[model samples]
Target: MEIATPMATDDRARFETLLSRHRGIVLKIAASYAWHAEDRADLTQDIATQLWRAFPGYDPSRPFPTWMYRIALNVAIGHVRRHAPHSRLTVPFDEALHDTADDLTNDRDGLDRMRLLQRFISDQQPLDRALLLLYLEERSSREMSEVLGIGESNVTTKINRLKQRLRDYAAAAGHD
Candidate 1:
C-alpha cells in the first residue's frame, strides 16, 4: 500500500466533498439498474469505489456530475450485462407505491401508468435504459453525448426513437 501524503489527504477530502454533493446521481443510477435494495446498495458502493479510482484523472474545470455519470452509467451497464442471464425485470414496488393517496380508486390510473412505464423501462437494453434515464433527468443532448460518448446528433436521434417507442409502449398498454 502507498503511504498517504498531504496531497493525497487533500485529494481524498476533495473527492469526499464532491461525492457527497452528487451522491444522488449514484443512488439514482443504482436504483435504475438494481431491482433490490441490497443490490442497489452494492452497486452504489461499487460506483463510489470506481469513482475514487478514477478521481485522479478528473478535471476540476469540468462538471463533476457529467464525469461521475459517465463512470456510474458505465458501471451500471456493465453490471446489468454481467447479470443479464440471472437478472429479473422487476421494478421495486417502493418506486410506484411511495406516494400517498387518500383515494385509492382515483390514483389507480396514475399507478397503472407508472407501473407500465417502469415495466417498459426495465425491459429495455442497458444502453437504452441509460439513454431513457438521462432523457428523463432532462440532460441536454450535448451532456448526454459527452456522458454516453456518442455524438450530439446520435443522442438526438436515439432520444427521438426512444420517445416514439415509449409512446407505442404506452399506447399498447392502453394508457392513452
Candidate 2:
C-alpha cells in the first residue's frame, strides 16, 4: 500500500472546491440571519474565513459537506453574536445580499419578512440554525438529526419550538 502525502496546493484546491460548492448555502444562510446587507456580507466573509482556517483540519475520510456546514454555521452564529448590529432592534437591511445577483425588486416587503425571520433564526444556537436550515430545506428529520448529531425526538422538539418561536416573533413584529 502507498502512503499519502499532504500537499498545501492540493489542500488549497480542495478548499476552493468546498468554497464554490457551498458558498450559496453559506451566503443564503448568512443572508437570512444577518438580514442587513453589510452584516450579511461580513458574516459571509467570516464564514469563508472560518472555512479557510478550518480547511487544514478537514478529514478526507469524512463527508465534506457536513463538515463544511458545521464550520460555516459556527462562523455565522459567532458573527451574529460578536458583530450583530442591535440585538433587540431590527436592521433596516443587510447590505450584503443585494450585492448578490438575484432579482429581488418585485418582492421588497417579502424580503423584509425574510430578513426578520433570519434575525429570529440567528437568535438560535449554531446547531439549531443548522437544524432549522435542514428543516427549511425540507430535509427529513432523520437526516437533520444525523447531520446535527441529535436524536430524532430532539430534532422534532426543536423544530416545533422553532416554528412556534417564528409564529410568535411574526406576531410580535406586526406581520400576519
Candidate 3:
C-alpha cells in the first residue's frame, strides 16, 4: 500500500471542495440527459468518478466550470450513446412529462411549460441537446465552443438556429 503524503492529502481535500461546490452542474446535466431517477443517480456517480480521474490533468489557468462541463458533457453523451440506440433517442414525450411532473411541485402552468420545453429538448439530437444545455446555462459563445470542440461562428450559428426552433415550437404549442 502506498502512503499518503501531506501534499497528496491537501490535493484530495481541494478536489473534494471543488467537487462539492460544482455538484449542481453534474446534477443538472444528469437530470437533463437521464429520464429516470436511477439513471440520473448513476450518471451523477459516473460524472464524479470521471471528474476525480481527470483532476490531475486539469489546468489551473482555465475556469474550473468550463473544464468540468467538458468532462460532464462528454460522459453524459457517452452514456446516451452506449445505453440508448440512435434510432430510439428518447421515451415518448407524454410518458416522460408524466414521469417528471410527479417530481416537480411547481404550479400547473409552469410545470406545463417546463414539460413542453423538455419535450422539445428530448426531440433534439445529442449535440443539439448539449448546445441547448450550454445555451440555457448562459455560457459564453467562446466557452461553449471550447467545451463543444466547435468554432465560435458555428456555435453562434447553432445557437441562433436553436433559438428559432424553440420559438417556433413554443408558438406551435400555443405558448406564444
Candidate 4:
C-alpha cells in the first residue's frame, strides 16, 4: 500500500472545499442532461467521482468553473449517449421546475417559462443541449470553447444557430 503524504491530504481538503462551493454547477449539469430523478442523482454522483479523480490534474491557474464544467459536461454527455437508445428524454417539468417550496409558492409564470425552455432543450441533440446549457449559464464563448474543446468561432456560430433553432421551434409551437 502507498503512504499518504501531507500534501495529498491538503489537496484532498482543498478539493472538497471547491467541490462544496460549486456543487450547484454539478447539479445543474446533471439536471440538464438527466430526465429522471434517479438519473440526475446518478449523474451528480458520477460527476463528483470524476471530479475527485481529476482533482490532482487540475491546474490552479485556470478558473475552477472552467475545469469543472469540462468534466461535468463530458460525464453528462457520455451518460446521455450511453442511455439514449433505451431512455426517453421526457423530463417531469412541473416537478423539476419547482425545486423548492419557495419556488413552488412564487414565480409561477417564470417556472412555466423555464419548464417550456427545458422541454425545448430536452428535444435537442446532446451537443446542442450542452451548448444551450453553457449559454444559459452565461459562459463566454472563449470559456465554452475551452469546456467544449472547440474553437471560439465555432462556439459563436453554434450559439447563433441554436438561438435561431429555438426561435423556429417556438414559432412552430405557436409560442411566438
Q: Which model is ahead, 2 or 3, in terms of TM-score?
A: 3
Q: What's the CA RMSD for each of the models? A: 2.9, 5.4, 3.2, 2.2
lDDT of 4 by residue, 38-60 (tens): 88999999999999999989999
User: Best TM-score goes to which candidate?
Assistant: 4
State which candidate, 1 or 2, has the greater TM-score. Answer: 1
With a 3 Å backbone cut-off (N, CA, C), the pairs that clash in candidate 2 are: 32-118, 35-94, 36-93, 36-94, 36-95, 37-93, 37-94, 37-95, 37-96, 38-95
lDDT of each: 0.85, 0.71, 0.85, 0.85
In model 3, which range of ten residues has the least summed lDDT?
A: 86-95
For candidate 2, write residues 62-87 as lDDT tens digits: 77766776777667666656654566
Q: Which portions of model 2 miss their true places by more than 4 Å?
A: 1-6, 84-129, 146-149, 164-176
Q: Across residues 55-129, which tens digit of lDDT does each residue of candidate 3 receive?
A: 989998999999999999899889889888644434234554576776764588888788778788888877888
Q: For candidate 1, report its TM-score.
A: 0.89
Each prediction's TM-score against the native? 0.89, 0.65, 0.85, 0.90
Least lDDT summed over 10 consecutive residues: which range in candidate 2?
Answer: 88-97
Q: List where candidate 3 sits over 4 angstroms from the true fold.
A: 86-108
